[model samples]
Target: MKDVNFIFIREKIASSYLYFISFLGLITITISLLEIKIPSHSTILILLLIFMGIAEYFPVRFWRGTSSLTFPIIYAMSWQFGIHITIIAIVLVTLIIHLHRRSPIQRMLFNSTQHALSLILAEWFSNKCMHLLINNIDMSVLYENLISLLLFCVFFCFFNNRFYDLLMILLPQPYSIYQWYKKTVTVFLCETFGFSYAALMHVLISKYSVEVNEITVLFFFFPLVAISVISSFSVRIRMEKERLYELFLITTEISRGLTGGNLKHIKQALKGFFGIQAYGIWTKDDGNWNLLLKDGKVHFDISDHSEKFEGISKNLVFNDWKTGTAPGDEIFDSVIRSLVYFPLIVNDELVGMFVAGKSRTAGFFPEDVQSLATFSNQLANVVKTRILISEQEKRMILEERNRIAREIHDGIAQTLAGVIYQLESAQKKYRDKPIDMQQIVEKSIKDLRGSLGEVRYSIYALKPYPTQQLGLKQAIASKIKSLKQEYELDITYHERGHARALSFSKERAIFDTLQESLQNIVKHAQADKTDVLLSYQSEHVLLRVKDNGVGFSLFESMVKTKNEPHYGILHMNEQAEQLGATLQIDSSVGKGTEITLLIPDSQTRGA
Candidate 1:
């Protein structure tokens, strides 16, 4: 509130200062006009030009350029002396030459020359027009001179230092139009009241037909002082309000843009929001801060603080710190102001820190600090959600690997071991007899081929061909063939309804589940015949693997105590779940085990 009042006061004072300069210029012009002796037209023109040149100086430096000379020259000649054409041409040519000059001294010298030349043109034109417009009236010379001086004074006040400074200070700040209007109103009121009071005092002093008294002069001072105070307060209030609003906008924009998925977006958002000198986000890896994002193209030196952040698991907590304040400790103090290191926490663990520095402005205020904390909290949530999803995906992958490993060990590995045992037995029998050499070779070749077949089957199981290459029906048929050949079971395959290619995931899951069910039938079901059927219904693709074997009760076996293993049914259900399918199993004492898998027909039809 005090800051706002201060800015208001400043603006009020600035506006009054401009009015005072105008009043002084008016007084100078009035005195010149009321002179006892009539000055030569040339002298009057020269004096006006000098005042115009001085007026041009303020705007020139205020604009930080030499181009403002045009405003005063054009106003003085066209309005006061009525010398538009010749004076304008000379001023244009001189301004062009002046701009082309490299040195400031040369530019100023050219400017002075142009002012003098313009004065001469104005005097010549005025002198010629005076004779034609007014024959016996020397009043023409007096009027022209007085008007020229008045115009010069007015132009001088318009380009005065106080006026230009007030404008420059307000223009680039936010809410410029409102601030300008407020200042203008304050100045208008002050000038109006001052003039009115001065007029009233003049009237009161002359009531008795006497000269203006000291009391009347003192009365005039009150309005000038009041104008200065009011203008200052108005200017200060407007500026403070504008600054606070700008800060609020910056915070809101930064918050909305700094979502955690894109590191570049976060950095860009922060840079625009804070207008800081330098800032970055660093990910904490193995106790070290790794730079992930930075504003602009600054190369930050992390060598010194590498060890400090290396083992710091949580956010590097700093007390009484701010966004850009250099670190309080000796090592980090040189390059930074206050450092705000906020941890990017996810799932109750810290992932990274939003480390920022402030150099261009003072450290963040309380509002900015609170805003930063809120932004960090939001960032942490995003980072945490992403991390959790990633971990879940990784766990799923590991589980899949384990399932594959179990399948290889139980099916292909066991089959190869049996082949090896058979070959060894055949080898011992052949070593004892020479007459049955051909039979031994045939038996050994058979055993080796069986091992090779099992190896091939394992490879195929690990990486099946695309469903498009061979339809899902053909792929399932192939797997059944391999199982029949390898296991030598009385396996029967059947298909019903229209068969079509299924989605990759659906096909893989159905094939894997079928394999597990058949393996269970071969290893556990003691029945002589096994039947596998594939069929499509209105909304689902169904696969049933049934075997007339020594079936155990699924419920009783699944509920067995700690020492028992029941991975086959669990694996089959998991595969179905993965493909968004359903699995059902039925088994009873003295009855065959029947397993059915139902996959959505839409999925199989490439929905």
Candidate 2:
């Protein structure tokens, strides 16, 4: 509750700040326009405005924001017709662009206000510098006022960036140092370009006529627009590559079945890549659609009729709220100007739905739709794969239960039944023959003990292996002690190098390999002693089990196990391979067998 209250207070403060800035900005513009005087060269002014609009339209986009060639024209205009004219012109251009883009009213206000304030400060700083440079310098002397013009560009860039930073602080978007540096460099470059072009325009206007300078301005701006268009194309190509890379990462995560744990990461990546404000994933459970994942602001009910989903299953459905072309306005909030539904289908079957929404009508372009379709297809396949894996796991569990049930019936159940029969016989014979009853009772007691042992063994087998609870070394030591007590088989355990924690899978595989090796020796190796060595290296961990017993041919054993019920070696090898490890068996007739399990570093980290 306190956190919520704190957040509410912060938002209120930010809102107040924004309103204050906007009010100041409006007041400044009103006052400035009251003193405004139209210049004599209306045709040149119109040409400059046109060029400014073009520059604003084709901004060089970066991750954080955009850069544009408007600075040169704005600076030049301020030098020619004063700061008020420059401010009004830029503000008008900004308002038009924002309105065309359907930007939020608050954002547009904030941006316009910030830009106006920065210009006012820049103009003030430049005037002070001009006075400091020369007692009474005429603005018409382009060569004499060069230093002042350069200083104006510098101060304007600084003030503009500072205001933008303040805006970011108030709104609070994610920050990146690399993005900040890139934006700073790009902005500086644009300012330099603007300074150079404005100087050239000043030179032309002073030497030639304002009319001649207008033509030069026109030609100069055309090339700039062309360059901006090229840059925009390059940015789009980069975005495409980034999108493909992001999809590859998501695909790898899904393939590893890590989606359950990495859903947050996936959501963030998708949101950043597509620039969507909200998204949701729904999966079909039985006959009902269930929401699996949802992120960002969601204002409307997602649980619409099944028929609506079925209708859109054939293709993606896009809705534009601004034009009233949306068929399902109730499904999304009024704030969402554009909403899209991508049916998650597999083999012509509607398995689920992926819904994404943005606050702009042209949010989903043709290329964006293509990418989203690919993403939806990938998600559908993953959902299907998850379902299939779940079913397979359940089936395996059921089979294991049946196997345990049979074991109980064949071993403990029969033994208990025999003990009951013997006890019943003894109870009946006790009255007639007391001496004979003692022997019968003793025999029944022994049978009961055997049944108890079988029950205990079954319980032990059902529980998790010791390696899972205890560390690998401790578990192996316990097993060796037990083997020594039970079979009187001489065993020695050795360790080398520093031990580090390994992943559960790697540990389990190593432990299982040890068990299989010992079991093979106990059953068939008619030998006296065995040795287990665990060596940990920088890049890999090695576990070797050597038995001084009657070893068999490795090739012959593998071939025989292929047909026979014995698959201990094959199973161990398969386990090692699955973990990107290696299992090697070195054995020959009459020579002792050696089993080595080498697990690389990749399998050992992330416990």
Candidate 3:
């Protein structure tokens, strides 16, 4: 069971005791007004009521399973037949009135009927036990002993289901069932001993009054008290065991969820573990607090007191009580009695606040405070890790941009500059010596054509290819058309499987890699035809570029080259790794090269 929930139950029991005491006072007043002669034995009824109230309200160290004291007390009072009848009637009336207030008349009547029947059975059993013990037997005093047993049965009938429900809600299946069994046995044993003690007391006070046998009283008292104490202790041990087990289970769930990087699951585990009314983590965003995760429904509008957080600096640690003028007063005016706030710090900056609220219990204790702090620390670590990963991604993007810029400047820009210089020199020579006009014109046209080719290449590199402009299917078709036109190579491109809009980074990488592979096939492979196939599977996006031409051993080339400057293969591999993909190359002498690039889907990326 959550510690907070257990505390709430404890508080409810205490409040119930006060209510019971008030009921007893009302009974006393009613009897006095009726001019009824209160029997000395009737005092047992008031004493029983008080004891039951105390047991319910106070946190007793002993396990006294609500039955131990309740049965004996009720049994002792049952001897006063008139008082028992009056109290029973009052109980029935109270139940009827309570139910009627909350439910429809028909439902209230039905519920009242059930409660009335239970009470009737209890009264009937009490009367029968009394009659049985008072029969003309050698042990007439046994009548008193029978009272405890009868009361135990009556109380068990009334509360067994309730106890079972409580355990089921608070504990896991196996432990809850075990606790229910233990409680049942404890109740039976306690009632037996209590009844025996009552019988012995009757024998001593009435039958052996003249003899005054101290030894007999001692013998009975020792065993009776021992039985009650032992039963109570056992019940307590079981409750504690169940409590600890629940705590361990909650902790395990929280740890597992956090390790798996599920912030939502972690938040839910924390809320369940602590039994808080509502909990949330608020992150700072551009001088405003934004709710990141929350558990439970909150009715109050937090925006009403936005000014409070507005002045609070980012990265500042602020507990619920600390930021307010009064220790416990805050902007929110809901059922939350206490609020714990932890500032999530990453790299010495306050990133967010882990806020948890209390509802049916007192503020967090020292242990709870420590736990909250630990949870916040773990939460901060997760946030920090995410931030670092994001930073690394940004850095990689910057580096890629710089490299692309350099490649454009070296390959295309420098070539265009050389062509421009040659054309300008030829134009000057044609103007100076009009005698060689044909040679100068041819030279100028050649240089101009070279510049135009460089410009076209640069533009083609900038334009979105068919694959990127449309999709991989169209891109492959476009590539095949270009190959047929440029090299007079009959290329057949085929596509199979479903297609999807891949991430921009992955799409760019795959397109560039395909471009390089096709270029290599045209420039190096001596083949008549080329075939490219693109396939999409459930796990990955696959692209295969092949050429029926002279192929070289991939493994041999890698081993032979130290600084081969084979940017095509190297760049392709780098892009694949960045997209969390895999690239495989297959080739052999006198055979075509089959280059395959597999970009995994999001689900397969993890694997």
Between prediction 1 and prediction 3, which has the larger lDDT? 3
Residue-pair clashes per candidate: 29, 0, 3
For residues 1-607, could you state the per-residue lDDT of candidate 1 as single tens digits?
4743665575566446545544543343344335424223544345445433333332211012222323333443344345433243334444555455433432334343434343443455555555564675555443544444444433333333244445346321233556445654544443344334334433443455544333433343334434444554554456446545655554454445434565555554555454344555555544555555666423546435433443444434342332233332222322233455566766667666666555312245444565566666776665555556667989998987898688768866776677677667776876767668567557757766766766776676667464556767777777778877888888888888766656677777777777788878777787789888888676888989998888898776666633322246776677788777889888887888888999886634454
lDDT of each: 0.54, 0.76, 0.56
lDDT digits (tens) for residues 1-607 of candidate 3: 3744664575466445434444544454354347445555444444444443333232223221245433333344444434434345434443545454443333233333333334445666666666675674445444455454556455535543343344234321123456567766655655565555555555555765633233442353445445546656766667557545655655555444334356655665555554455666665544566655666534345433433443333322222222254222243334354566676777767666666765422345445566557667776666556556667989997987787678668755776677667667767776767667666556657766766666676577667766558775566567668878998987877777766667777667777877888888878888788777777788887888888899988877676554543356777887888888889999999977998899887534422
Q: What is the lDDT of candidate 3?
A: 0.56
Local distance difference test, candidate 2? 0.76
Query: Which candidate's lDDT is highest?
Result: 2
Q: Tell me the TM-score of each prediction against the true structure.
A: 0.36, 0.58, 0.46
**What's the residue-level lDDT of 535 in candidate 2?**
90
Best by TM-score: 2
| 2 against 3, candidate with superior TM-score | 2
TM-score of 2: 0.58
